[model samples]
Target: MANFKKGVALVLAAATAFTFAPVANLAPVTASAAATQIADATDLNLVLGETKSIKIKDISAYSIQNYTVSSSNKNVAYVTTTTTTGAAVSADGATTGASLTFNYSQVGKTFDIYAAGNGTAVITLTANNTNGAVVTETFNVSVNDKIEHISVKKTSDNSELSTAKPLTIASTDIKATPAASIKTNVTATVANRAGTTLKAVSDDPTIVTVANGTGNTFDITPVKIGSTTVTVTDTDAQDKILASYTFAVTVARADETLKVTYDSNRDGKNEDYKADSTNGHSKQGNAVYLDDDKTSFQIVAESALGRKITYTSSNPNAVSVDNNGLVVVSDKVKQETTVQHISADISVKTEATKIGTTTVPAAEVVVPVHFVNKKYTTLSVADAEGNVIAQTVNSPVDLADTNKDSKIDASDDAVITLSTKDKTSVNLVVASNAGDNFVSGEVFAPATNGKIGTTKSDVVTYANGVLTVAKTDITTDTRAFLVLEAKPSTATYGANAKITLQILVTTKNANNVIDVAKTLDLNASTKTATIAAKATYGNILKYELVEADATQADGYKAVAGNSNTDLSVNASTGLVTYKSKNSGSQVVRITGTSNATAVAPKAAYVTVNYSVKKNASDLAVAAKSIILEEGKTAAIGATASTAITYVSSDESVATVAADGTVTAVKAGSAEITVKAASDDKFDEGVVTIPVVVSKKAENTVVPKPAKVTGVKVANVKGAKVKVSFKKVSKAAGY
Candidate 1:
């Protein structure tokens, strides 16, 4: 029986070792040998009001007799245990009607650790094994406030406020005529603490007030015109003074009184009222010109805070006031026969007191206004020299209708047309001219509606009439008597007349005396010239053949050798042509006759002169041959009554210019020819000259020559004399 019992005990021991050893190898547990092993559990790190579950494991291969759970800081963190039977046990270690029971079946049980507040707590689990061994397990649990970040920002824009710098609220100007007020909202950001409320309080409520219970936002208003401080803190952590932000606020005082002024002219200057009892009108220092488009007066205030000014007009029909304190004279006042004086009241009130209970007195002033006529006149046309061009008794010059409307108006004042002679320019000037009631020192123009406009005038151009005549040379026979007759001679000449021609006898040669029996009448006004026709024995138009020389003294005949084929006589056209047979001057009388008897005919004569040229001869040159060195130029001496052309026979040796200057080309001889140009009075001639060019002399230094002691005359004849002198060595040729 002992052997059998020993065998059973050994088997039971092996079974226990095998069962518990595998469990221990699965998960390592730590505890005293006699105590129940507790599996290692992760520490709890949680936020406020958060819970974590820790699983309990037994690795000792022993049954758990009982278990108890407790927390070191119950207010910060709490612990509860659940047995394998599903019975819940609180930190005091009691279950529903009994104590917690634990064994191998409760190895997988769990203990729940809850975070009650922001602090650290240790949860201890004690379990006693059925073999009388006890094991304790502990876990550190941390509870943190849910807030992850904190910041302050403006509620309106959500802009973060700076913590490093004190927040400053802009001040208000309470002393201003109208006191200024300002307010703003600020909110705090508590991330992960969405339902938490923040509190904001001002250090000095007298200067600034912060409204509370407005969620995360607080309203900050300026209480008085001074400075104060405000602090914001988290209500949840009220005792944590380090987590608070303080800001500074300031309030400014504004001016107490507003200065108001009346600028009747709106020239930025105050005007004084002037009462005129006699005229039943009052003037505001200066007159408001009725001619100006802007005749309204303005009232201005000194302070922009209380700039609102009320303007009232006494006479609504004659004047009106606008919201901007501008007093405008009505059109009815402008159309009045006499000047009208207008009155207006301007008032401005000061700002309310600090408590908003009392009202400050307002400033009021009455301004008198006056209207005056701005006398102006129209524009007058003138020349560029400032000479006024107006209508006169003899000459009625009207202003130009520039628009072509056939009416003189304002648009025409800029430019005007004036009559001018050909090839001449006249400035059509326009200048300000005073009218019946002109105002001194005031400019006037047509476009200005009797107001000041252009101070200078512009110019316009007018073209002149051109005149031309049609006529050709006369070719006729010498024997025929040519009589010029004017066709359509009854025209006139003047500013509106056609151009006319006048003829007269300008010259008569010594040999001939032609008779003109009728008196020539040339009238420019009639555009006519006339010569009477003869009847019976009277010859009003006469042409007598005159001799050019004694050889043909009886009567000159046409020369057959004349090359002029256009010379002929046409008696029907009154055209005559004569070629002299001898070299002498002759005169012929030609009379012009008008087709109409009322038109006077003009008379004009012609004188014929001829000359005979000498026969051709050889051209002569001053020198037959010229000698020049290389690189030298000389003039070929030749003269003629007519123009002469020069030519070089050999340009390689020498060149001759048109003006007869000859340049030596090299050491050689050349022949230069001179020929006279064709002329009616001189015959053509030709001459030739020989030019010899020698080598240029070399430049060399020579000893000074002896000076001449005396000069003796060997022979003298008229202006020629032979002089002798002593010879010197190295002398240059003279």
Candidate 2:
């Protein structure tokens, strides 16, 4: 029993046995020798993208107790279970890469672990029982490395169709070369089909640039039925390559049309139709029209012509012609004015239609010459050759048709009146007859009748025959007659031809008054006749006025020679007359002669040609006004000048010095005047002096020394000067 008890104790202590009692039976007891638990490590490996399953057999005698799991060193997987087993089932955890973790739990449960090579995880199966002892079994699982995926795509949005990869045309096959080390590779081959054509290029290859890259599509078009292939290669830096693609090429027809125009005439056309050549166009805008259709039309807007036209497009695209044959454009244009090279003609008309008809030509014409026959004077006619011809007999005495057109007019008629110096007058008649025809004619001192034409007789005629004067003349040698006529005919006549005539003596009645117009030309200084007028014979008192016409060089004037007339002139009639002949231009009055005398005595010593001065003698002085600007001093040697004394009426208005210097006192006019002293040899005269004192005086002084060292002093008695000098000192030596 003792042995048995010791053995039992040992059994209890050393043997792992269990005892049990049923009901009142024995209670179960299990003696477990403190198990020396053990854990071991199993290593696993997996590839990326590959799943691996690991069966972990419990090599340890004791079950693996619960323990921690870890995959701290790998990027592939996470621990699905921290323990081998529990109320939670053992898990074959989801993993990635080549590795994963499976940890121990209770002693009896199994745990699964998986890895995809790159997935590495560490699991320690720690054995744990009711005993305080614990152990861990570690498992290192990793998945194998693998190639996951391969794909190709454009980096950009790849939207532009023109730059996009080419599409297969008619199933073209193109070949490519790939890198040699690749286990799996893809390649492509492309060929243009016989009839297949590429899509219309959004952009031509010439314009859109293609970048260098692994894969790119180049589009091409083929001409006619042809096949062309392009090879593509994808390679690494070391010439290791991937798949490549090729595109087909096809050529297609493209069509477009354009229209343009040019200027027909470089001269700009105006927009305004009414504008003539004087107005011109300024600008031209050139444009082109593009059309897809083969048919084309053109519309040209010409700024110069201001016109727009539409027409079928010519090769040059300009509007060539209008509907009409007119080469000029129908549109109005501004243009310069010039004779048109057109078919239109021009004609001119005038009121005086014919040049050689009644209107005479400006050219010279021939005229006949004739003379009047008088009783006391022989008459004659002559041709241009100087041959004497008998007078035409009994021509009608119609002076009106002087131009020889058979028309009567006043221009062709000649009229006259007569007067005499002895207050005698006469009446006479004349006509344009066998003696007169030219536009102008001269008169002679005879009538066509057998009587002498006295100073009181006159005759006038034109183209018509003449009428004789019925006058009686005194049988005096001074008796004269007046005859008037024109050129004998409208034939050649000398300009200086003399018309000869004769007349009988005539007597004049002394009681008759005759007045005639005369002309006089006088020399301005002398009032003497340069040319004298014909003398008049008339009762001078009967002539109310003597009128003068200044239009002619020695114009006519009618003057009275009678002494019983007022000394008055009619300014409107340009007439001069007087109450008596003593007041006429030829009348004279007696006046005293003046003698000049010296005033101031000669200076201390001098000689001079001084103006002779006269005393202030009381005489008939004429009141006259004169004008001079301000600051003006007048030197009036004398009123009558020469040897006369002149004094201002009011010496205060202007002062007169002994030297005849008249100085203006103020701003006003003064008269220092006098009439000419009457002398039988000189005409009456008057003088006017005007003095105007302006703002300032302008004086010019001439200096004359009392005695000049080198110059010869002139007029020394009337001039004086003062000399000044600085004191002089003797030189040091002196």
Candidate 3:
């Protein structure tokens, strides 16, 4: 009994000692030691639609046994494991026997973990070593739906359309004699999102209607003359509203018209007339003419009724009437040498019986007429020197129609060719009958009568007539010069002697009134007397000869060539050259004793002054300063009386070429200089310009944080709650 108790006590004590021994003290046994424990762990981060790879380094002494992966949301994110020798395996926790395995030779190897998809998902990867040491890593993956942009366009014109106010339509267009409608369509474009539909709705269907069309298009139509609103909304497949727009529309009615009435005399008033009981007619004022030929008079057609009227002349040969009641003298009247007066009667008839009624004749109106004789006895032609070349019934003169209208009328230009070659200036002289007086020149119409119908002293030039003034040299000591002067300034006409100046200077500036410095008024007593020699010239002055007054002067008339009114000056030389048609001798003369005499007339001359300066020395620059960016170029524009040379102070900052092209090199300042080239006409000139160059901009990158996929509340307590989330990458700064 004593020996058994001692042995059991020894065994129990030995077993207790073995059980209490520390792990570090018993290291060198058989079998492999526990695989190296994972010393540190790291979570994963991924974006929506992005795949991330996690590399886990194995530091174990033995091969890995297995690795299992699980995900919180399989639809949002899933995991796959890849090894060096085997194909990748999906490890979403739903696959059976899905684990990564390593061989003995693959000890201390690394494995790849992949996570991909959209939305928030937690990926848990549990890895076990051959010795049963386990480690778990969680990865938070986030996926987002990014919307790039949205656009709306009109389907008709494909133009971007927006409205902040109401659009109006006319009721006449929509509700005319037949029903009409206005239609417009629009389309919406959603970018970076899928399965989106656009819908349109109207606030008042009675005023406007909206309907859907093919492929993101909507049509709107007008229904009535009222105001309404149309709303358009964009939505996704899940009925999530993305965008909405509204437009207001209005319809309006047409305008009304006013009443109409006749406005005689154009005085904006109506006049009334009464018919005589005995004569059945009303009398208007008499139509008068100076000669036996026809003449017209205007009669007021005033009435409340706007009706057409008819006109009738008693004698067609004496007078004729038109639809507007304008009576004209007939052209077929025989020319009577004896002075006499004639008469004609005109009547007017209306188509209205009463006011605003178109039935029987309303009334009859009569207009009286009178004519008288103003005849010419003799016609004569004279030259520029006031000498008679031909006379009516004496010279073999021919009356040809100058206008070629197939009729011999007053407008026809006469041709008088004498045996002499002096045909430059000519005039027509008509001697009136002793009792009758000549009317105004305006009364002579080409279609009225065959007479010349002009005064006895009217100037008439033959074909190709010209008038010229010869250049005369005059010297003076004063700086201001008198270029031209009219002599005598006065003249008289008589049977024994006649005095006149054939050529006269009328206007000095033509008709241009803008440039007072360049224009001269010949009618003014004082005028511009000097001009700079080096300044632009030639449109500064103009002159003309009074041909009509010259003919009446009794001494001179205009001839051919330069004597014609169509005269001009040389734009560059400021000189006048008069050319004659038959190249006849140009003469200016005063008349002595009757048509057979001649006298010398006083003349006119133009004078010019010379300047002391020889040339111009002006220098100018267009711009005083300019700003430019780096790497930009500009022209250093400068002007002088002569050519110039350009230079840059600092070529590295801004370089200047020979053609004045300035190029900015970098961010700095420089000076540009321009100097005049050698020239005798102008003095030397120099100009300087400052230039600045700007620096280039620096490039910077800003990362966009990943959008939140989801959020959840946990550990809720009265007023506060704990928030958890699938975190984004730290590099994204969120």
Q: Which candidate is the best by lDDT?
A: 1
Per-residue alpha-carbon lDDT of candidate 2 for residues 1-734, written as tens digits (9 for 90 to 100): 00111111111110111111111211122333233322222354432332322334332343322233344443454333223223332222333222223233222332334332344565433333334344333455554322212122222221123233333223332221111111212222223212222222312343122223233333332212122333344333555333333433322111111112322211122111111122221112222111111111222321111111222212111112332211221111112132111111111011111111222111111111111121111123432345433222222222222333212122331122221222233232222232433423333443234233333334322222232333324343122323334444433222222232332222332322222223321222222221111112211121222233443222324445422233333322323332331212322111111112111110111011111122222333232344555556767654442234456666656666655577776666566654455442244555656655555557866444333234343453547744444333432221
Error of 1 at 319 (Å): 7.7
The 10 consecutive residues of candidate 3 with the worst lDDT sum are: 476-485
Error in Å for residue 318 of model 3: 80
Q: How far is candidate 1 from the true structure (C-alpha RMSD, Å)?
A: 47.2
lDDT of 3 by residue, 532-558 (tens): 222112222322221323223243343
TM-score, candidate number 2: 0.16
TM-score of each: 0.19, 0.16, 0.19
> After TM-score superposition, what is the CA distance of residue 327 in candidate 1 from its true location, in Å?
3.3
- Candidate 3 stretches with Cα past 4 Å from truth are 1-624, 637-642, 649-653, 665-670, 682-688, 707-710, 713-734
Residue 316 shift from truth in candidate 1, angstroms: 13
Write the residue-wise lDDT of candidate 1 on 1-734 in tens digits: 10111110111111100011122222223444344435445455554554556666654354444445567777777765554467565653233223443345445756566667667876655544444555555567776432211122222211143243232333222221222234566655554443334677887887677897566677776654456666776534444332355655555433223444554333334644422222222223333322223457665544322222455666666667675666677777666655343443333332221212223233334454544322212333444566554311100011122222223233332222111122122333332323212211211122334222333212121222111111112121001000111111112100111111111111111112224433322111111222223422222453333324323312244333222432333333333343333344434335333222211122334443333434354456777788999989998778777788999989989999988899998999989989986554356888889899999989987666578756788658788889887776666532
